[model samples]
Target: DFFWFNPSRLPSPAEWVNVRRIRVKDAVDPLWWMSKSAYPKANNRRVLEKYSDSMIQLIQNGYKAKLRPSGWDISTKFQKDNGGAIPPNLLQIANTESNSWYLRECARSGVRPHPARYPSRIPKFFIEFLTDPGDVVLDPFAGSNVTGEAAEATQRHWIAVELRVDYLIGSKFRFIRPHPVLAVPAG
Candidate 1:
C-alpha cells in the first residue's frame, strides 16, 4: 500500500488494477476506505488536497465515512463515555521518529534503517479498528516489521515478509525474543 513516487506521479485511475469488483465473505471484508498517514511536506500539499477531495467525493458516491481523532485530545471538552471513536479516512499522524527504539537498535547494531518505516501508530490504528484480537495480520512488504510488532502487542497472530535480507535482520531487533518460526535463516 506504500507508494514511493510523488503524488503527482501517481497512476491514473484508468491505469490501475480494479479490485472493487472482487467479492469477499464477511470474514475478510475490507473497510470502505483504507486509512493512511502522509508526511506533511510542502511538495505533497497539492496531491494530499486532491486525495482528500476524492475521498469526499467517494463519500458522496455512497461510501460509508467515519471521522475519528488520531489520538486522545486532553483539551477537548467533549468526551465519549462509550468505546473509542471511529477513525477517519484521512489519518493525521506524523511519520517522523528519529529516536524510536527501532532506529536506536539499528544504530547500535550498525544496520541501515529502513528509509520508509512508518510510525507504529498508523498500523496499530487500522488494526484495532478493522480487526479483532486473535485475527491474523499480514504485512507482505514489512520493511522493519512495525506492523508485526503492533499486531503482536495487540495479541494478534502476524506474518511479515521482507525482500531484503539486511532489513529482515534489522527488523528482528524489534522483538524482545524472536519467535523461532518467524526468524529469517542466515544465508
Candidate 2:
C-alpha cells in the first residue's frame, strides 16, 4: 500500500524542493516521512530537521490535514483496541544490529552478509498495515529476503526473487526449512 525508498539517498535540500514540486502534482494523500534506517550523518540530520521545521510551521499555520474517510472508523477501532495511536509515517526503526540472527548465521557459515540489507521492521510495518494475514506478498528485489521472513512470520504467503545466488542461499538461514518450490535457470 505504501512505497518507500531509502532515505540515505535523498537529494540535497535545494534539489528536494524541485522534487517535491513535481511530486505534489500527482500526490493525492499525505506524504509519510519515514525515518532513516541508520542514524543519519550530520548533513542528513540537518536536512531532516529543516523538513520537520517546515512541516511544523505548516501545521501551526492551520494546514487542515485530512484522514482517509473510508479508513477513519477502522483506524479509530484499531487505536482503541491496540491502546496506541496509529503510527506516524516517520518510522523510527534502527537498521543497524551488531548481533542479529542473520549476522550470526553469516558469521557461522563464513558467508558475508548483504551490504544493503534493511531492517525487517520496515517491511513488517507496511505489511501489517496494508495486508491481511492470508494475503500473498511479493518482493521483487529480495536482497537478504527480510520481507519474506516478515511476511511468513505474519502468516502471509510470500514469493521473493533475488538475482544473486549467494545472497539467496544466505537468506535461507532465516527460514526453518528449505522452500518447497525452488526454481533456478538451467545452466
lDDT of each: 0.61, 0.63
Residue-by-residue lDDT tens digits, candidate 1, 70-167: 76443322322212233335555555578877788889889998887766866776567556789777787889899999999988889999999999
TM-scores of the models, in the order given:
0.51, 0.52
Best by TM-score: 2
Model 2: residues >4 Å from true position, as ranges? 1-82, 177-187
C-alpha positional error of residue 25 in candidate 2 after TM-score superposition, expressed in Å: 28
Q: Model 2: which ten-residue window has the lowest total lDDT?
A: 40-49
lDDT of 2 by residue, 1-187 (tens): 2343444433335444465554322212232323344442212211122235444455445444456777643232222222223344565554456787788898989988888777787777666665678977788889889999999988889999999999997898888543447645459
TM-score between candidate 1 and the true structure: 0.51
| Residue clash pairs of candidate 1 | none
